[model samples]
Target: MDFIFFDADGRYFNFLCLYQILYKPVILTIFSAMQTMRWAFMLCTISQLDVLIYNFENMKELVKAGNCEINEAFKDGFKKNIVHHCAIIQFVNTIGRAFGGQILLFFMINSFIICTTAVQFFSIPNPLNNIMELVWIFGFLFIMIIMLYIDCYFGTIITEKGSQISMTVYCFPWIDLKQDLKKQFIIFFVRNQQDLVINASKLIPVSMTTFRKVMNWTYKGFAVLNQMRK
Candidate 1:
């Protein structure tokens, strides 16, 4: 235990030897798991959206040839598709809900970490003494920002593709459909109009907008801290 808990000469080395080895690795693992889960959800959502879009394209192809008669089988298949899509959407939402609180906490803690690291890096006068500390802070800052960017980018993709599904439905020849089928299509379109947007704790929608906001906020906060330090 003494050997594992021993401190090094440099601050960064000490941190790496103690917290990094004992605690940071665990924290990183958890974050990695969350990130992987998020990526998986986004991919699944996109792939399912692709499937729906393909179905819509096929329907469009059928209707393009003046064949407006939608068979009973097609109607049934459409209904099943609706259910499948809703399930996928709901699953993502559930994932968001389950992890949203943790995500918020993660962002808050990371922000603090970045702030303190920046302060230490910029405030310290002796560069030789704290070179490792500078490198450590910079590395973490870069990695965290990159991770956030990927998260928001993928989230944006999910929403955009989900919204396009409704548009795909609209592209179909609805006017020529039988009255009952037309009614069903109308209902489906209306349902899809809601679109799929997974929010973090219902506060921040996980999209590029959030990414920009976070970056701006971090920068402003860092600037303020820097001024306070001076």
Candidate 2:
């Protein structure tokens, strides 16, 4: 019994040492590549956020006293728009969250298979090695996958919101049926008309400027996430 335990412990230590020898270079390369991707995603995302904030602040600077009344009018108009669309937003957001979860699960399972297969390739040098290699690969992949999704979402939202907000700024009194945004909103989202009415009631008290900001955000959020999924 003592002899068997001694052999097993020695083998475990040997495997540990082998892991240290083989692990760093390959794992570091993968990590470095992933880090580069994450950094690029972050830079793009941050640039978009910075642009949005810059434009929003610039718009704030341009506000005059007479615009305050227009702001109230906008508030009323935006309130109605939101109430008409709030339910639809809730439904869309719910679907988005559900689908996002599903996609994440798929990535996790897919990554697991890839890592498991990779472990087989790694074991060619010492075919009899135990399960520790797989554990490390999976641990590393899981962390990277999380990073991937976060960066992806950030990049998507910033770009989407930035462009959409800019467009909204250019077209404030955009109540025309001929306009693209209102047309789509009416067609795709106005199916839940009661939801829009309820949403507008909640939005009306906050002022049109506030509601417009939120609507812009919601619009951009959908656009960003949709791009990310693509």
Candidate 3:
């Protein structure tokens, strides 16, 4: 521990002590706010994915009644669901665009933090002396990874569920419907052949593939730091 200054009386003040006394609470409060925001983002993303999955199931159920008897109500309901699905996709994309920069910045900073923390952990001379500090850094790094994974996981689910809509349409009892209705259904199915993807500002997609890339970047950074330390 280094002293910041010493008085004529030989009394010393430490920067770390000042940090604990005057800055720790502020830092903790900022971290708390960030964690809250992340939780809200995750909740909203997952809810949208759940809505998508529910709509897919509804479509599948609609087609299960294979009596060529899709009532007006059922048709209306299906149309409404299609609109609802579109709305969800739009909502997610809007959010992705809005937070893309923030998320990208967070991941970049997190990668650097991981690299530095790993280097410190490996270079520490006395494990017992800094064990608590290492644990704190590791805990934060783990939380960040988990949060990133969750965001990617929900986005992947949304993509998969959206794509599954076409499969559900294919499994429908199109042979039992009137020719006109069958043609309309075919058009709808064709429109849905392409999957809905939510991208980060239309750049990187939010998926496991991106998550894996981020982790790889972190590892590469850590290795580079280790080499530099030598």
Candidate 4:
């Protein structure tokens, strides 16, 4: 009777363990899906900007080659490009407003996670004996770093492409254009002189510079943790 009761208890414990093991994968799957969606949205926005940049470049080339005729139709095209540019900036601003808070939160959480994980991994006395543990921790760290990098990389691309628009317009042979067209070109040039940048919560500009700062903070945090452990 005692043996039977012990076996029954062991079986119940095993069932609970199995349930937990199965549940974790489901949660990870949901998280992975969400990350995929976020990346897809970012890529879509980048592609739209790329298309607009291409249009601007093409127009610049035509103007430079003296193929562009400065007439009413040309004026219309110039105005249209300016409107399109403004529309894209507005769209980017909308995205920034919508996801700015979430982006800031992500950066904070990832920085903390990276610092803590690095400290814990480095603090282990015998990593060879704990190969599986090391691999799991390393994988988590790598994923966080990659995710943060993707966000910053995309932001840098946006800034570079945006600034290119001003350069393209500036290179156009505006001196040969009619008085009115030259004035329009000057306005466009001045307007685009400010590079487009996406900000996090209207505070932090999301760029490679921000990425470097985050890494610096992460290192500082890791150093502090190590000192505390010692």
Candidate 5:
């Protein structure tokens, strides 16, 4: 029930009243923007997971096929799976962001609610009332920065390292734990991966034209995606 600048004007008026009047719409606008961000993250997560599952399934099938039948594209696919697995880590990181942002949003909404009630005690407020505002506004920002950094940088590294384990542990229950299919899958995957390396080894003397074409295709795809993001 603390307040600030309650001196003159018979102390009937409170600064918080003006503050709320001016701040509510702005806070609501930010809340709306956060909702949009949340939705976008959800859709983005779904899209990434869908692509990952699709590509992983396709690559798994290619690996299940014998090496003699594997093609260069399928070899590229094996490489792509590693990248996709890495991407899954990133998508999971996005989940952390989505969750953390919602937490922040809750804090924001709570702050707004506090603002509404804050003036109620203005009549019997202490001289330190203004300090409450500064504490919430500034302290909350500091907490948010730490939250985002920890979730993005620190959590990503941990999750990326754990991703292989997560893939195995989490999916083991769904997969047939029998010996036959397990042996077949490992043998098939390893044989194909090694064969791909062997095939690639033989093609190390790639033609300059093929190398340039690959470089061009990669650059073009990167540019397109970058542009789309922009």
Candidate 6:
């Protein structure tokens, strides 16, 4: 009976080891790939916005150089550019709708992870004895912080670039153009007066401000946990 029990236990241990060695890595790899794709999508959106801004800048240069003739063709091209701007805004809104929930969850989870990791790192009694463990913990903490920063950084860029459009439109020589074109310029300028902002689940604005708040909350939670431990 004792020999049979030992064999069964050994098999169970091997099964768990195999699951950990094989299954966990595969699952983690899939998750990492998904995250990479999501960020890539965000970057693609930003690049599109950059292209729109570049076009606006080119238009401004043409107007400044007195090369833009106020004719039917110019009017048609101007209207098309406004339409393109609206299309880009729609694309941004679509991205927010698709990824807002995921972004919210990411912020929540990373905040908890950061707080707990900090507490654990500080709680360790013998820093020199468990060097590898310490390194692992620090690496994870760094990655979490970096991920948060990247998200917020991109969000900031989007807001800044979007705001730049209004200024670019303002710089156009609208006063010297035809009355109809002046009206169109006014409408476009008024439309762009509001800065573009991406919100998480339509609740949290995903900018540097949010990033700072998350870090502050994490620090507060870490302090509280340390106090409880003491």
TM-score per prediction, in order, is 0.79, 0.32, 0.75, 0.84, 0.34, 0.88
The 10-residue segment of model 4 with minimum total lDDT is: 1-10
Residues 170-205 of candidate 3 have per-residue lDDT tens digits of 665556667776777777777777766667667778
The digit string of per-residue lDDT tens for model 4 on 132-210 reads 9999999989999999998888888888888877876676556767888888888788878887888889989888999
In candidate 2, stretches whose alpha carbon ends up further than 4 angstroms from where it belongs are: 1-30, 65-138, 167-230
For all candidates in order, the CA lDDT equals 0.76, 0.44, 0.69, 0.80, 0.44, 0.81
- Residues 29-129 of candidate 1: C-alpha lDDT, one tens digit per residue: 98688778877877877888888788777766665665654554347557777887878788878868886786667667666676667776788788889
lDDT of 5 by residue, 1-230 (tens): 33454654644565666775768788979866864564465445445555655664554465456442334434455456556655655664555544554544443444343333333323233647577765665565455433333323332333233333334323322243345545644553443231101011223211233334434544465455545545
Candidate 2 lDDT, tens digit per residue, 1-230?
A: 12334454564767766666778887989866754653453454355445544543343443443454434444345444444334334543443343345434433454444444444435445544745765766566566445544534543553354345444444554353335556644443334332211111222211233334434544465455545545
- TM-score winner, 4 or 6: 6
Estimate candidate 2's alpha-carbon lDDT, on a 0 to 1 scale: 0.44
Runs of candidate 1 exceeding 4 Å displacement: 1-27, 65-76, 124-135
Q: How close is candidate 6 to the true structure, as a TM-score?
A: 0.88
Best by TM-score: 6
The worst-scoring run of ten residues by lDDT in candidate 6 lies at 1-10
Pairs clashing in candidate 6?
none
Q: Better model by lDDT, 1 or 6?
A: 6
**lDDT (0-100) at residue 155 of candidate 5?**
28
TM-score of model number 2: 0.32
Ranking by TM-score: 6, 4, 1, 3, 5, 2
Considering every candidate listed, which one attains the maximal lDDT?
Answer: 6
The alpha-carbon lDDT assigned to residue 116 of candidate 1 equals 69
Task: Judging by lDDT, tell me the better candidate of 1 and 2.
Answer: 1
